[model samples]
Target: MIALIGAAVAPGIAILSYFYLRDSLEPEPISMVIRSFIFGMLLVVPIMVLQYIMQNEWNWRDGIVAEVFQSAVVEEFFKWMVIYFTVYKHLEFDEPYDGIVYAVAVSLGFATLENLFYLIINGTNIAIWRAFLPVSSHALFAVWMGYYLGRAKFSKDAKHERLFLWMSITLPIGLHALYNLIFLAVQNWLVVIVPFMLILWWQGLKKVQRAHDFGSKNLSSRPQ
Candidate 1:
């Protein structure tokens, strides 16, 4: 049991730490970060209830439409709502990288709890893959969402803000949909997911770098 708990939690902490540490300009308060994570874990209940309703309605079947529209859309939408409503306007979200940090906290919170449930039922054998795949993917998705949202929050142009606001939700949905599609449609999904994950990591890293750059510039331009 201890091992299972550790296995489930370790990846989320690692991923969260990686992004949080990157907030070199202004690290968010640990309390806020933990709060975001708890909010993410709380999301599982409502999301599961909604998915259960969809399942009963036959709208969440194991098919393309179900995976994309039902699962991906529902999950990403809720995560987006949490970030937007909860911390997007907080004074602590003062820098670009802070978005990534908070978004990642929420995402990994959800992922870690979900992982714990799966590991409890399936045992620790699959923990490694779960850590590498679903857990990591959630972090990557948060990166994209956070990147655009940070931009939107800080943008001076209304048009750009609107564009990024939409992108914050839409982009993660699309990527998550593709990820779900591959799992449901492909026979040998392992081969495909590897490359897909690599691309996702690359994109996520680039966004992190850009956010960091934006933070650096923001700091430099401040009335220091």
Candidate 2:
């Protein structure tokens, strides 16, 4: 029971840290952030339920194509859509980095629930592995998605704007699919995926820094 609680709660805390860090730069009201987190989790529940059904019906042995399309594709699509339609337009999304912030929130929300389910069924050891790697990977995936979303939000060029928006969805989905494939092919190779996750963390940090710099510049230029 202690292990189960840790497995369920730890990822949510880790993902919440990203928001707390971002809040340091451009502080959102705690109430708003809490609302966003809850909403994000609420929005993804249907997708999770659907995935559960599909997994039982088709199973991974069906083939790579089926697994990718039915599992990874379906899950990522719904998560991304929730961010794009619901969170993207929120007033709190005032800067480019806001994209990354909110995207990570939604992704982590989905991941937290998914992790809890897996941990409950599989047990503690599997939960430990998932807590470190897959949970972090989902956070990284959101980082990139938010990076492109920031670009799309801030870009002046119409073509570039559209490109960034599309890339925001596609790139994360591709990374997510690849991550799933790697785990599917050789579960032992998760150690190798750690470096890729590190790269993603670096990328997310860069985007956040860029957004901070941009906001700083704008503030400095404003007449008092």
Candidate 3:
């Protein structure tokens, strides 16, 4: 029970951070940001259901190996698809930061739902840690994915645009897979997991700042 509660904290902070950051960006109206968050949250229903089905159907003898690949494919694919199909065309996605905001929102939403389920089944003790770290890590992964995506969407340089597009999709999926692999390998090392998650969050913050800085510069350089 305690663990579950702990786990929930991470996602909560990440979600809140995403909204706060979105508010800081001066590109779109508050309503648009809120709408995106809601949309991102809504996407979790289908993703979770699909993942559940896949996991049950594709059960394997080795838990670690099975979870690492399956979890990555199920989570990353759905989150990316939601951002691409729903939020990408929205007017709110006017700036590069918008991509990161939307992506983080979606990722956090998925984490929230997943966390809730794990907490309920495991109890509050387990929930606590999950709330703080895994959830946040998921958000960080989304931020990394979103940064590149935002760059691709807003970039005028053709080469940069393509590079960003690929990174946007690949980076998050890769990181997510790596995280899963780590969990599979080190299921009991709470100390190590904590530091690793912190590193992921730190990296995410850097990515967000970089995207924001780049966007600001581009916006300023545009002709009046």
Candidate 4:
């Protein structure tokens, strides 16, 4: 039980630490970060309810459509909701990178809980795979969502804000759906998985750099 708990938790913490460090220019308050994570954990309630409704009505037989709906849309939508209602407009969300920090907290919070249940049922042998895949993927999903959320929050131009606001939700949904599509199709896994991981990594890293750059600008502009 202890090992399972650690296995479930370690990935989320590692991912959280990575993003927290990325926002080194101006880290958000620990209280807010913890609050975001707790809110994220609560998101599972709405997600499960929505999935039950969708699955009952649609009945895709666990095919591509159902996979996308259940895994990507359902999960990302809840995570997005948590961010929008909670930290999106917080005063501490002054700089763009703050979005990344909060988003990561939320994502990992959900992911870790999910992991605990999964490992408890499936045993710890697959813990490594769970850590590498689902947990890390949640962070990547947060990266795409967070980058735009941060931009949208600080955006002065309406059009700019609108575009990023749309991106914050839609981009993750689209990418997540795509991943689920290929994940469900696992016949030639590498063909899709390789390219998807590559793109996810490339884009995720680009956002990290952008967030870092924005943080730098904020620091330089502030009065010493």
Q: Backbone clashes per model, in order? A: 0, 0, 31, 0
How far off is residue 12 in model 4, in Å? 0.7
- TM for candidate 3 is 0.83
What do the candidate models score in CA lDDT, each in turn?
0.92, 0.74, 0.73, 0.86
- lDDT of model 3 at position 6: 55
Question: Model 2 misses residue 89 by how many Å?
Answer: 1.8
Instruction: Give the per-residue lDDT digits (tens) of candidate 3, residues 1-224.
Output: 56555565456655756545554556565565556556656766776666566667666436664565557766787788888887777766777887887787777766776777777787766665676667777788888878888888887888998898788888888888877777777858676677788788788878878888877886788789
lDDT tens digits, residue span 1-224, model 4? 99889999999998898788767677788899988888887776677777888788767566877878787888998899889988887788889888888998999899888888899999999999888778888899999999999889877799999999999999999988887778777899768777777788888989999988977787688799
Model 4: CA > 4 A from native: 57-62, 219-224
What's the distance in Å from true for residue 53, model 2? 5.5
Q: How much does each candidate deviate from the true structure in C-alpha RMSD? A: 1.1, 2.7, 3.3, 1.8
TM-score of 2: 0.84
Among these predictions, the greatest lDDT belongs to 1
- Residue lDDT tens for model 1, 104-138: 99999999999999999999999999999999999
lDDT of 4: 0.86
Off-target runs (Cα >4 Å) in candidate 1 are none
Off by over 4 Å in 2: 52-61, 217-224
Two-way TM-score contest, 3 vs 4, winner: 4
Q: TM-score per candidate, in order?
A: 0.97, 0.84, 0.83, 0.92
